[model samples]
Target: MTMFSTIRLRAAAVLASFALALSGCFLSPGKFTSELVFTGPDSFTFSYEGEIFFLGLSKLAQMDAAQAEFTPPECYNQETYESQECSAEELADARANWESGAADRAAEAKKKAEQMAAMMGGIDPSDPKAAEELVKRLKRQKGWERVVHKGDGVFDVSYRVTGTMGHDFMFPLIEGFPATNPFVQTFVRQGGQVRINAPGFATQNPEQAGMGAMMGIGSLAGLAAMRAELDGQGDAMPGIPVIDGTFTVRTTRGMRVLANNTDEGPEPNNTGEALTWRITTRTAQAPTALIALIP
Candidate 1:
Protein backbone atom coordinates (compact mmCIF):
# COMPACT_ATOMS: atom_id res chain seq x y z
CA MET A 1 0.00 0.00 0.00
CA THR A 2 1.10 3.60 -0.68
CA MET A 3 2.49 5.59 2.29
CA PHE A 4 -0.34 8.16 2.04
CA SER A 5 -2.97 5.44 2.04
CA THR A 6 -1.39 3.80 5.10
CA ILE A 7 -1.27 7.11 6.95
CA ARG A 8 -4.96 7.76 6.20
CA LEU A 9 -5.94 4.29 7.35
CA ARG A 10 -4.04 4.70 10.67
CA ALA A 11 -5.69 8.08 11.28
CA ALA A 12 -9.14 6.59 10.71
CA ALA A 13 -8.46 3.75 13.12
CA VAL A 14 -7.39 6.14 15.91
CA LEU A 15 -10.42 8.31 15.38
CA ALA A 16 -12.74 5.30 15.44
CA SER A 17 -11.25 4.00 18.68
CA PHE A 18 -11.58 7.39 20.32
CA ALA A 19 -15.21 7.66 19.31
CA LEU A 20 -15.99 4.19 20.61
CA ALA A 21 -14.44 4.99 23.95
CA LEU A 22 -16.31 8.26 24.27
CA SER A 23 -19.66 6.77 23.26
CA GLY A 24 -19.35 4.25 26.02
CA CYS A 25 -20.10 7.11 28.43
CA PHE A 26 -23.86 7.11 27.80
CA LEU A 27 -26.69 5.43 29.62
CA SER A 28 -28.06 2.02 28.56
CA PRO A 29 -29.89 -1.05 29.97
CA GLY A 30 -30.70 -1.66 33.61
CA LYS A 31 -29.84 -5.35 33.93
CA PHE A 32 -26.76 -6.55 32.10
CA THR A 33 -23.46 -8.44 32.49
CA SER A 34 -19.88 -7.36 32.14
CA GLU A 35 -16.44 -8.89 32.18
CA LEU A 36 -13.34 -6.70 31.99
CA VAL A 37 -10.02 -8.47 31.63
CA PHE A 38 -6.80 -6.48 31.78
CA THR A 39 -3.93 -8.33 30.18
CA GLY A 40 -0.55 -6.76 30.79
CA PRO A 41 2.87 -7.21 29.18
CA ASP A 42 3.72 -9.95 31.67
CA SER A 43 0.54 -11.92 30.87
CA PHE A 44 -1.00 -10.57 34.02
CA THR A 45 -4.78 -10.94 34.12
CA PHE A 46 -7.00 -8.93 36.42
CA SER A 47 -10.67 -9.93 36.47
CA TYR A 48 -13.52 -7.99 38.05
CA GLU A 49 -16.74 -9.57 39.18
CA GLY A 50 -20.11 -7.96 38.56
CA GLU A 51 -21.24 -5.02 40.68
CA ILE A 52 -23.36 -7.23 42.94
CA PHE A 53 -20.40 -9.45 43.67
CA PHE A 54 -18.23 -6.43 44.23
CA LEU A 55 -20.64 -5.01 46.76
CA GLY A 56 -21.02 -8.40 48.36
CA LEU A 57 -17.25 -8.71 48.62
CA SER A 58 -17.07 -5.30 50.19
CA LYS A 59 -19.74 -6.29 52.72
CA LEU A 60 -17.77 -9.40 53.55
CA ALA A 61 -14.81 -7.20 54.34
CA GLN A 62 -16.86 -5.03 56.71
CA MET A 63 -18.90 -5.85 59.81
CA ASP A 64 -22.61 -5.48 60.41
CA ALA A 65 -23.75 -3.80 63.64
CA ALA A 66 -27.37 -4.82 63.97
CA GLN A 67 -26.65 -8.53 64.06
CA ALA A 68 -24.38 -8.33 67.10
CA GLU A 69 -26.18 -9.09 70.32
CA PHE A 70 -25.32 -9.62 73.95
CA THR A 71 -25.97 -12.88 75.70
CA PRO A 72 -28.85 -12.90 78.17
CA PRO A 73 -28.06 -13.33 81.85
CA GLU A 74 -28.24 -16.83 83.22
CA CYS A 75 -31.72 -18.06 84.16
CA TYR A 76 -30.61 -19.26 87.57
CA ASN A 77 -28.05 -18.38 90.21
CA GLN A 78 -26.11 -20.93 92.35
CA GLU A 79 -28.88 -21.05 94.93
CA THR A 80 -31.62 -21.52 92.34
CA TYR A 81 -29.53 -24.09 90.44
CA GLU A 82 -28.96 -26.14 93.59
CA SER A 83 -32.56 -26.07 94.89
CA GLN A 84 -35.21 -27.91 92.85
CA GLU A 85 -37.84 -27.66 95.59
CA CYS A 86 -39.44 -24.32 94.67
CA SER A 87 -43.25 -24.13 95.15
CA ALA A 88 -45.43 -24.61 92.03
CA GLU A 89 -46.98 -21.13 92.55
CA GLU A 90 -43.58 -19.45 92.71
CA LEU A 91 -42.44 -21.21 89.51
CA ALA A 92 -45.61 -20.12 87.73
CA ASP A 93 -45.01 -16.46 88.72
CA ALA A 94 -41.44 -16.65 87.43
CA ARG A 95 -42.63 -17.91 84.08
CA ALA A 96 -45.20 -15.11 83.83
CA ASN A 97 -42.53 -12.43 84.49
CA TRP A 98 -40.25 -13.88 81.86
CA GLU A 99 -42.94 -13.74 79.18
CA SER A 100 -43.80 -10.12 80.07
CA GLY A 101 -40.16 -9.10 79.75
CA ALA A 102 -39.89 -10.76 76.33
CA ALA A 103 -43.00 -8.92 75.12
CA ASP A 104 -41.56 -5.58 76.18
CA ARG A 105 -38.34 -6.28 74.27
CA ALA A 106 -40.27 -7.13 71.14
CA ALA A 107 -42.23 -3.87 71.28
CA GLU A 108 -39.05 -1.83 71.64
CA ALA A 109 -37.48 -3.56 68.67
CA LYS A 110 -40.44 -2.76 66.45
CA LYS A 111 -40.35 0.91 67.42
CA LYS A 112 -36.65 1.17 66.65
CA ALA A 113 -37.15 -0.44 63.27
CA GLU A 114 -39.84 2.05 62.36
CA GLN A 115 -37.64 4.95 63.37
CA MET A 116 -34.74 3.72 61.27
CA ALA A 117 -36.94 3.22 58.22
CA ALA A 118 -38.28 6.75 58.53
CA MET A 119 -34.77 8.15 58.77
CA MET A 120 -33.76 6.35 55.61
CA GLY A 121 -36.46 8.06 53.54
CA GLY A 122 -38.83 5.15 54.12
CA ILE A 123 -36.36 2.75 52.56
CA ASP A 124 -35.80 -0.74 53.97
CA PRO A 125 -32.33 -1.17 55.46
CA SER A 126 -32.20 -4.70 54.10
CA ASP A 127 -31.41 -3.26 50.67
CA PRO A 128 -27.90 -1.86 50.69
CA LYS A 129 -27.39 -1.51 46.94
CA ALA A 130 -30.53 0.57 46.59
CA ALA A 131 -29.35 2.76 49.42
CA GLU A 132 -25.96 3.19 47.82
CA GLU A 133 -27.50 4.28 44.52
CA LEU A 134 -29.83 6.69 46.28
CA VAL A 135 -26.93 8.31 48.08
CA LYS A 136 -24.92 8.51 44.87
CA ARG A 137 -27.67 10.29 42.94
CA LEU A 138 -28.57 12.55 45.82
CA LYS A 139 -24.97 13.48 46.48
CA ARG A 140 -23.24 13.40 43.10
CA GLN A 141 -24.74 15.25 40.18
CA LYS A 142 -23.85 15.98 36.51
CA GLY A 143 -22.31 13.07 34.56
CA TRP A 144 -25.19 10.65 35.18
CA GLU A 145 -27.76 10.16 32.42
CA ARG A 146 -31.26 8.83 32.98
CA VAL A 147 -32.67 6.08 30.76
CA VAL A 148 -36.36 5.57 30.17
CA HIS A 149 -38.01 2.17 30.59
CA LYS A 150 -41.68 1.52 31.31
CA GLY A 151 -42.68 0.62 34.85
CA ASP A 152 -39.15 0.47 36.10
CA GLY A 153 -37.47 2.68 38.67
CA VAL A 154 -34.13 2.13 37.02
CA PHE A 155 -31.67 4.66 35.66
CA ASP A 156 -28.92 4.31 33.09
CA VAL A 157 -25.96 6.56 33.78
CA SER A 158 -22.39 7.38 32.87
CA TYR A 159 -19.91 8.00 35.66
CA ARG A 160 -16.46 9.39 34.98
CA VAL A 161 -13.52 9.69 37.32
CA THR A 162 -10.64 11.88 36.28
CA GLY A 163 -7.66 10.63 38.19
CA THR A 164 -4.72 12.58 39.58
CA MET A 165 -2.89 11.58 36.45
CA GLY A 166 -5.05 13.86 34.27
CA HIS A 167 -6.65 10.82 32.63
CA ASP A 168 -10.35 10.02 32.69
CA PHE A 169 -12.00 6.61 32.88
CA MET A 170 -15.67 6.46 32.02
CA PHE A 171 -18.11 3.82 33.26
CA PRO A 172 -21.13 3.70 30.98
CA LEU A 173 -24.63 2.57 31.90
CA ILE A 174 -24.13 2.25 35.63
CA GLU A 175 -27.77 1.61 36.39
CA GLY A 176 -29.28 2.98 39.58
CA PHE A 177 -32.00 0.79 40.98
CA PRO A 178 -34.13 0.08 44.06
CA ALA A 179 -34.73 -3.19 45.86
CA THR A 180 -36.00 -4.73 49.14
CA ASN A 181 -32.79 -3.83 50.98
CA PRO A 182 -30.81 -0.64 50.37
CA PHE A 183 -27.26 -1.61 51.25
CA VAL A 184 -26.24 -4.34 48.81
CA GLN A 185 -26.15 -3.54 45.09
CA THR A 186 -25.50 -5.40 41.84
CA PHE A 187 -23.55 -3.56 39.15
CA VAL A 188 -22.19 -4.88 35.84
CA ARG A 189 -19.65 -3.38 33.47
CA GLN A 190 -19.62 -5.06 30.05
CA GLY A 191 -17.65 -3.74 27.12
CA GLY A 192 -17.30 -0.52 29.10
CA GLN A 193 -21.07 -0.28 29.69
CA VAL A 194 -22.15 -0.89 33.27
CA ARG A 195 -25.59 -2.15 34.29
CA ILE A 196 -27.10 -2.38 37.74
CA ASN A 197 -29.48 -5.16 38.72
CA ALA A 198 -30.99 -5.78 42.13
CA PRO A 199 -29.28 -3.87 44.94
CA GLY A 200 -30.04 -4.97 48.49
CA PHE A 201 -29.29 -3.72 52.01
CA ALA A 202 -29.34 -5.56 55.29
CA THR A 203 -28.59 -4.89 58.95
CA GLN A 204 -27.66 -7.55 61.46
CA ASN A 205 -30.49 -8.17 63.85
CA PRO A 206 -29.84 -8.00 67.63
CA GLU A 207 -26.33 -6.94 66.69
CA GLN A 208 -23.14 -8.95 67.29
CA ALA A 209 -20.07 -7.66 69.09
CA GLY A 210 -17.04 -7.61 66.80
CA MET A 211 -18.52 -7.27 63.31
CA GLY A 212 -21.30 -4.90 64.30
CA ALA A 213 -19.41 -2.18 66.14
CA MET A 214 -16.10 -2.15 64.26
CA MET A 215 -17.56 -2.67 60.80
CA GLY A 216 -20.27 -0.10 61.33
CA ILE A 217 -17.78 2.51 62.50
CA GLY A 218 -15.35 1.76 59.70
CA SER A 219 -17.97 1.92 56.95
CA LEU A 220 -19.33 5.20 58.24
CA ALA A 221 -15.86 6.72 58.50
CA GLY A 222 -14.79 5.46 55.09
CA LEU A 223 -17.92 6.79 53.35
CA ALA A 224 -17.58 10.10 55.12
CA ALA A 225 -13.97 10.37 54.01
CA MET A 226 -14.87 9.60 50.40
CA ARG A 227 -17.65 12.16 50.37
CA ALA A 228 -15.36 14.77 51.88
CA GLU A 229 -12.66 14.05 49.34
CA LEU A 230 -15.07 14.41 46.45
CA ASP A 231 -16.57 17.57 47.88
CA GLY A 232 -13.20 19.20 48.53
CA GLN A 233 -11.66 18.15 45.23
CA GLY A 234 -13.81 20.59 43.25
CA ASP A 235 -13.88 17.77 40.74
CA ALA A 236 -17.58 18.06 41.58
CA MET A 237 -17.68 20.73 38.90
CA PRO A 238 -17.94 20.42 35.10
CA GLY A 239 -14.18 20.23 34.59
CA ILE A 240 -11.89 17.28 34.82
CA PRO A 241 -10.10 16.61 38.11
CA VAL A 242 -6.40 17.17 37.52
CA ILE A 243 -4.15 16.11 40.36
CA ASP A 244 -0.38 15.80 40.68
CA GLY A 245 -0.24 12.21 41.88
CA THR A 246 0.84 8.88 40.55
CA PHE A 247 -1.55 7.98 37.70
CA THR A 248 -1.34 5.23 35.17
CA VAL A 249 -3.64 5.10 32.12
CA ARG A 250 -3.60 1.78 30.29
CA THR A 251 -4.47 1.36 26.62
CA THR A 252 -4.53 -1.56 24.25
CA ARG A 253 -0.76 -1.85 24.00
CA GLY A 254 0.85 0.50 26.55
CA MET A 255 0.23 2.72 29.55
CA ARG A 256 0.69 6.43 30.11
CA VAL A 257 2.00 6.84 33.62
CA LEU A 258 2.29 10.16 35.47
CA ALA A 259 3.62 11.12 38.88
CA ASN A 260 3.59 14.08 41.27
CA ASN A 261 -0.17 14.49 41.22
CA THR A 262 -0.83 18.19 41.68
CA ASP A 263 -4.03 20.11 41.07
CA GLU A 264 -2.98 23.54 39.98
CA GLY A 265 -5.80 25.91 40.95
CA PRO A 266 -5.20 27.84 37.77
CA GLU A 267 -6.87 25.03 35.81
CA PRO A 268 -10.20 25.92 34.32
CA ASN A 269 -13.14 23.69 33.36
CA ASN A 270 -13.45 23.02 29.69
CA THR A 271 -17.14 23.58 29.03
CA GLY A 272 -16.73 22.18 25.56
CA GLU A 273 -16.74 18.66 27.02
CA ALA A 274 -19.47 16.74 28.90
CA LEU A 275 -18.10 17.52 32.40
CA THR A 276 -14.79 17.84 34.19
CA TRP A 277 -13.50 17.77 37.72
CA ARG A 278 -10.17 19.34 38.77
CA ILE A 279 -8.71 18.21 42.06
CA THR A 280 -5.53 18.93 43.98
CA THR A 281 -4.19 16.34 46.39
CA ARG A 282 -2.09 17.49 49.34
CA THR A 283 -0.65 15.74 52.35
CA ALA A 284 -1.38 17.38 55.70
CA GLN A 285 -0.70 14.93 58.52
CA ALA A 286 -1.36 11.22 58.27
CA PRO A 287 -4.29 11.80 55.90
CA THR A 288 -4.51 13.40 52.45
CA ALA A 289 -6.83 16.25 51.60
CA LEU A 290 -8.33 17.22 48.25
CA ILE A 291 -8.42 20.96 47.73
CA ALA A 292 -10.82 22.94 45.57
CA LEU A 293 -10.81 23.33 41.79
CA ILE A 294 -11.21 26.29 39.41
CA PRO A 295 -13.97 26.43 36.78
Candidate 2:
Protein backbone atom coordinates (compact mmCIF):
# COMPACT_ATOMS: atom_id res chain seq x y z
CA MET A 1 0.00 0.00 0.00
CA THR A 2 1.02 3.65 -0.42
CA MET A 3 2.46 5.66 2.47
CA PHE A 4 -0.78 7.50 3.23
CA SER A 5 -2.72 4.23 3.06
CA THR A 6 -0.23 2.67 5.44
CA ILE A 7 -0.65 5.57 7.85
CA ARG A 8 -4.40 5.12 7.80
CA LEU A 9 -4.01 1.41 8.54
CA ARG A 10 -1.71 2.16 11.47
CA ALA A 11 -4.23 4.67 12.75
CA ALA A 12 -6.90 1.97 12.59
CA ALA A 13 -4.64 -0.39 14.53
CA VAL A 14 -4.13 2.19 17.26
CA LEU A 15 -7.86 2.63 17.57
CA ALA A 16 -8.34 -1.13 17.79
CA SER A 17 -5.73 -1.40 20.53
CA PHE A 18 -7.35 1.41 22.47
CA ALA A 19 -10.74 -0.24 22.19
CA LEU A 20 -9.41 -3.54 23.52
CA ALA A 21 -7.53 -1.92 26.42
CA LEU A 22 -10.54 0.07 27.54
CA SER A 23 -13.22 -2.42 26.60
CA GLY A 24 -14.68 -2.47 30.11
CA CYS A 25 -15.08 1.29 30.16
CA PHE A 26 -16.71 3.13 27.29
CA LEU A 27 -14.84 6.18 25.98
CA SER A 28 -16.49 9.19 24.41
CA PRO A 29 -14.72 11.28 21.82
CA GLY A 30 -12.30 13.22 23.98
CA LYS A 31 -10.03 16.24 23.68
CA PHE A 32 -6.25 15.99 23.28
CA THR A 33 -4.16 18.73 24.91
CA SER A 34 -0.58 19.30 23.80
CA GLU A 35 2.15 21.86 24.30
CA LEU A 36 5.43 22.39 22.46
CA VAL A 37 7.98 24.65 24.11
CA PHE A 38 11.17 25.61 22.35
CA THR A 39 13.90 25.73 25.01
CA GLY A 40 16.82 26.56 22.73
CA PRO A 41 17.97 26.62 19.11
CA ASP A 42 18.12 22.83 18.93
CA SER A 43 16.00 21.78 21.90
CA PHE A 44 12.28 21.67 22.65
CA THR A 45 9.82 20.17 25.11
CA PHE A 46 6.56 18.43 24.20
CA SER A 47 3.63 17.80 26.53
CA TYR A 48 0.33 16.02 25.93
CA GLU A 49 -2.37 15.84 28.59
CA GLY A 50 -5.91 14.53 28.31
CA GLU A 51 -8.71 12.91 30.26
CA ILE A 52 -11.19 10.08 29.55
CA PHE A 53 -13.94 9.48 32.04
CA PHE A 54 -14.81 5.92 33.00
CA LEU A 55 -18.41 4.90 33.61
CA GLY A 56 -17.45 4.47 37.24
CA LEU A 57 -14.52 3.95 39.59
CA SER A 58 -14.99 0.20 39.28
CA LYS A 59 -13.73 0.24 35.71
CA LEU A 60 -10.54 1.98 36.80
CA ALA A 61 -10.09 -0.50 39.63
CA GLN A 62 -10.61 -3.41 37.24
CA MET A 63 -7.97 -2.01 34.90
CA ASP A 64 -5.54 -1.62 37.76
CA ALA A 65 -6.16 -5.17 38.97
CA ALA A 66 -5.64 -6.56 35.47
CA GLN A 67 -2.29 -4.81 35.11
CA ALA A 68 -1.16 -5.87 38.58
CA GLU A 69 -1.59 -9.55 37.71
CA PHE A 70 -0.01 -9.23 34.25
CA THR A 71 3.04 -11.38 33.50
CA PRO A 72 4.85 -12.36 30.32
CA PRO A 73 4.48 -15.97 29.26
CA GLU A 74 7.49 -18.21 28.53
CA CYS A 75 7.08 -17.49 24.85
CA TYR A 76 7.49 -13.77 25.51
CA ASN A 77 10.22 -14.18 28.14
CA GLN A 78 12.44 -16.33 25.93
CA GLU A 79 14.39 -15.10 22.89
CA THR A 80 13.07 -17.87 20.64
CA TYR A 81 10.59 -18.40 17.81
CA GLU A 82 8.04 -19.82 20.27
CA SER A 83 6.33 -16.43 20.31
CA GLN A 84 5.41 -16.79 16.62
CA GLU A 85 2.80 -19.07 15.09
CA CYS A 86 4.26 -22.59 14.74
CA SER A 87 3.33 -26.07 13.61
CA ALA A 88 2.84 -28.84 16.17
CA GLU A 89 6.39 -30.17 15.72
CA GLU A 90 7.84 -26.65 15.70
CA LEU A 91 5.97 -25.86 18.91
CA ALA A 92 7.40 -28.96 20.57
CA ASP A 93 10.90 -27.98 19.43
CA ALA A 94 10.48 -24.45 20.77
CA ARG A 95 9.25 -25.77 24.13
CA ALA A 96 12.27 -28.00 24.39
CA ASN A 97 14.61 -25.16 23.47
CA TRP A 98 12.99 -22.87 26.03
CA GLU A 99 13.35 -25.55 28.75
CA SER A 100 17.03 -26.02 27.91
CA GLY A 101 17.66 -22.25 28.10
CA ALA A 102 15.83 -21.80 31.42
CA ALA A 103 19.02 -20.98 33.32
CA ASP A 104 20.17 -18.32 30.83
CA ARG A 105 16.71 -16.80 30.66
CA ALA A 106 16.57 -16.60 34.44
CA ALA A 107 19.90 -14.75 34.49
CA GLU A 108 18.66 -12.29 31.85
CA ALA A 109 15.41 -11.70 33.75
CA LYS A 110 17.28 -11.09 36.99
CA LYS A 111 19.59 -8.61 35.30
CA LYS A 112 16.66 -6.78 33.72
CA ALA A 113 14.82 -6.69 37.07
CA GLU A 114 17.90 -5.21 38.72
CA GLN A 115 18.09 -2.49 36.09
CA MET A 116 14.40 -1.74 36.52
CA ALA A 117 14.80 -1.56 40.29
CA ALA A 118 17.66 0.89 39.97
CA MET A 119 15.65 3.10 37.61
CA MET A 120 12.67 2.87 39.99
CA GLY A 121 14.77 4.02 42.96
CA GLY A 122 15.41 0.63 44.50
CA ILE A 123 11.87 -0.66 44.51
CA ASP A 124 12.34 -4.43 44.65
CA PRO A 125 9.96 -6.40 42.47
CA SER A 126 10.02 -9.24 44.97
CA ASP A 127 8.36 -7.06 47.61
CA PRO A 128 4.63 -7.53 48.20
CA LYS A 129 4.01 -3.83 47.43
CA ALA A 130 5.86 -4.04 44.10
CA ALA A 131 2.73 -4.83 42.11
CA GLU A 132 0.99 -1.73 43.37
CA GLU A 133 4.02 0.41 42.63
CA LEU A 134 4.22 -1.04 39.13
CA VAL A 135 0.55 -0.29 38.54
CA LYS A 136 1.13 3.35 39.46
CA ARG A 137 4.15 3.57 37.20
CA LEU A 138 2.28 2.06 34.24
CA LYS A 139 -0.59 4.52 34.69
CA ARG A 140 1.81 7.44 34.22
CA GLN A 141 2.43 8.84 30.76
CA LYS A 142 4.90 7.16 28.44
CA GLY A 143 8.03 8.90 27.03
CA TRP A 144 7.71 11.62 29.69
CA GLU A 145 10.18 11.99 32.53
CA ARG A 146 7.59 13.83 34.57
CA VAL A 147 3.94 12.79 34.68
CA VAL A 148 1.40 14.24 37.07
CA HIS A 149 -1.96 12.63 37.64
CA LYS A 150 -4.37 15.51 38.11
CA GLY A 151 -7.22 13.37 39.49
CA ASP A 152 -10.59 12.90 37.78
CA GLY A 153 -8.86 10.94 34.96
CA VAL A 154 -6.67 13.87 33.95
CA PHE A 155 -2.92 13.56 33.34
CA ASP A 156 -0.11 16.01 32.58
CA VAL A 157 3.03 14.73 30.91
CA SER A 158 6.09 16.43 29.43
CA TYR A 159 9.27 15.31 27.65
CA ARG A 160 12.25 17.24 26.33
CA VAL A 161 14.06 16.67 23.03
CA THR A 162 17.49 18.11 22.22
CA GLY A 163 19.94 18.07 19.37
CA THR A 164 18.70 17.68 15.79
CA MET A 165 14.99 17.63 15.07
CA GLY A 166 15.22 15.57 11.87
CA HIS A 167 13.05 12.42 11.87
CA ASP A 168 13.28 12.13 15.65
CA PHE A 169 10.20 14.32 15.91
CA MET A 170 7.97 11.54 14.63
CA PHE A 171 7.40 8.89 17.28
CA PRO A 172 6.78 5.30 16.24
CA LEU A 173 3.23 4.71 15.02
CA ILE A 174 1.14 1.53 14.96
CA GLU A 175 1.94 -1.18 12.41
CA GLY A 176 1.77 -0.23 8.71
CA PHE A 177 2.66 3.49 9.06
CA PRO A 178 6.37 3.97 8.41
CA ALA A 179 8.21 6.59 10.41
CA THR A 180 8.60 8.73 7.29
CA ASN A 181 5.55 10.11 5.46
CA PRO A 182 4.91 13.04 3.12
CA PHE A 183 2.77 14.70 5.80
CA VAL A 184 5.86 14.90 8.03
CA GLN A 185 8.10 17.48 6.36
CA THR A 186 11.79 17.46 7.22
CA PHE A 187 13.14 20.48 9.06
CA VAL A 188 16.26 22.23 7.81
CA ARG A 189 18.45 24.08 10.28
CA GLN A 190 20.21 27.23 9.04
CA GLY A 191 22.65 29.07 11.26
CA GLY A 192 20.76 29.40 14.60
CA GLN A 193 17.32 29.01 13.05
CA VAL A 194 15.25 25.99 12.04
CA ARG A 195 12.02 25.88 10.04
CA ILE A 196 9.42 23.12 9.94
CA ASN A 197 6.08 22.93 8.19
CA ALA A 198 3.16 20.62 9.12
CA PRO A 199 0.31 20.12 6.75
CA GLY A 200 -3.04 21.54 7.83
CA PHE A 201 -6.49 20.20 7.03
CA ALA A 202 -6.93 22.63 4.17
CA THR A 203 -3.36 22.31 2.92
CA GLN A 204 -3.26 21.59 -0.80
CA ASN A 205 -1.48 18.49 -2.07
CA PRO A 206 -1.48 17.17 -5.61
CA GLU A 207 -2.18 13.60 -4.54
CA GLN A 208 -5.30 14.54 -2.53
CA ALA A 209 -6.44 17.60 -4.45
CA GLY A 210 -8.78 15.91 -6.90
CA MET A 211 -9.49 12.80 -8.97
CA GLY A 212 -7.56 14.30 -11.87
CA ALA A 213 -4.55 14.78 -9.58
CA MET A 214 -4.71 11.16 -8.33
CA MET A 215 -2.40 8.47 -9.75
CA GLY A 216 -5.47 6.72 -11.16
CA ILE A 217 -9.26 6.74 -10.90
CA GLY A 218 -9.07 3.32 -9.21
CA SER A 219 -6.86 4.73 -6.46
CA LEU A 220 -9.28 7.58 -5.78
CA ALA A 221 -12.25 5.18 -5.69
CA GLY A 222 -10.37 2.85 -3.35
CA LEU A 223 -9.65 5.69 -0.97
CA ALA A 224 -13.31 6.64 -0.91
CA ALA A 225 -14.31 3.04 -0.17
CA MET A 226 -11.85 2.77 2.68
CA ARG A 227 -13.06 6.01 4.20
CA ALA A 228 -16.65 4.84 3.99
CA GLU A 229 -15.77 1.58 5.73
CA LEU A 230 -14.00 3.45 8.50
CA ASP A 231 -17.00 5.74 9.01
CA GLY A 232 -19.46 2.86 9.14
CA GLN A 233 -17.33 0.91 11.60
CA GLY A 234 -16.93 3.95 13.82
CA ASP A 235 -20.68 4.50 13.86
CA ALA A 236 -21.26 0.89 14.84
CA MET A 237 -19.03 1.05 17.89
CA PRO A 238 -20.55 1.85 21.28
CA GLY A 239 -20.48 5.48 22.30
CA ILE A 240 -17.70 6.14 24.81
CA PRO A 241 -16.86 9.16 26.90
CA VAL A 242 -15.28 12.01 24.92
CA ILE A 243 -12.14 13.97 25.77
CA ASP A 244 -11.47 17.58 24.79
CA GLY A 245 -8.15 19.40 25.22
CA THR A 246 -6.04 22.24 23.90
CA PHE A 247 -2.48 22.44 22.55
CA THR A 248 -0.23 25.45 22.91
CA VAL A 249 3.21 26.39 21.60
CA ARG A 250 5.49 29.00 23.19
CA THR A 251 8.77 30.18 21.68
CA THR A 252 11.82 30.22 23.89
CA ARG A 253 14.06 33.19 24.66
CA GLY A 254 16.19 34.67 21.83
CA MET A 255 13.93 32.94 19.32
CA ARG A 256 11.60 34.97 17.15
CA VAL A 257 8.25 33.50 16.18
CA LEU A 258 7.86 33.21 12.44
CA ALA A 259 4.41 31.98 11.30
CA ASN A 260 1.75 29.60 12.63
CA ASN A 261 -1.85 28.78 11.74
CA THR A 262 -3.09 27.41 15.07
CA ASP A 263 -6.04 29.18 16.66
CA GLU A 264 -5.71 31.35 19.78
CA GLY A 265 -6.95 30.21 23.18
CA PRO A 266 -8.85 32.24 25.80
CA GLU A 267 -6.05 34.81 26.05
CA PRO A 268 -4.52 35.44 22.67
CA ASN A 269 -0.85 36.51 22.56
CA ASN A 270 1.04 36.46 19.27
CA THR A 271 2.79 39.86 19.01
CA GLY A 272 5.98 39.19 20.98
CA GLU A 273 9.33 37.39 20.84
CA ALA A 274 7.66 34.46 22.60
CA LEU A 275 4.40 33.77 20.80
CA THR A 276 1.73 31.17 21.57
CA TRP A 277 -0.55 29.14 19.30
CA ARG A 278 -3.47 27.22 20.72
CA ILE A 279 -5.70 24.53 19.23
CA THR A 280 -8.63 22.96 20.99
CA THR A 281 -10.55 20.04 19.53
CA ARG A 282 -12.21 16.67 20.12
CA THR A 283 -10.34 13.41 19.56
CA ALA A 284 -11.18 11.11 16.64
CA GLN A 285 -10.66 7.43 15.76
CA ALA A 286 -7.62 8.32 13.65
CA PRO A 287 -6.58 11.68 14.97
CA THR A 288 -3.98 13.88 13.26
CA ALA A 289 -2.63 17.24 14.36
CA LEU A 290 -0.08 19.52 12.73
CA ILE A 291 1.93 22.63 13.58
CA ALA A 292 4.69 24.80 12.06
CA LEU A 293 7.56 26.11 14.16
CA ILE A 294 10.43 28.37 12.99
CA PRO A 295 12.97 29.44 15.52
Candidate 2, which segments miss by more than 4 Å at Cα? 1-29, 51-142, 145-168, 171-186, 196-236, 239-243, 263-295
Q: For candidate 1, lDDT tens digit of each residue in 120-227? A: 345444455544645464335443332221212232223322222122222332334222222212222222322211111111111232222312311222222332
Predicted candidate 1, C-alpha RMSD? 23.4
43 Cα displacement, candidate 1 (Å)? 26
Q: What's the true lDDT of residue 8 in model 1?
A: 33
**Candidate 1, superposed: residue stretches over 4 Å from native:** 1-94, 124-216, 219-295
Per-residue C-alpha lDDT of model 2 across residues 176-216, encoded as one tens digit per residue: 21232221122545445444442210111223343223222
- True-structure lDDT of candidate 1: 0.27
Highest TM-score, which number? 2
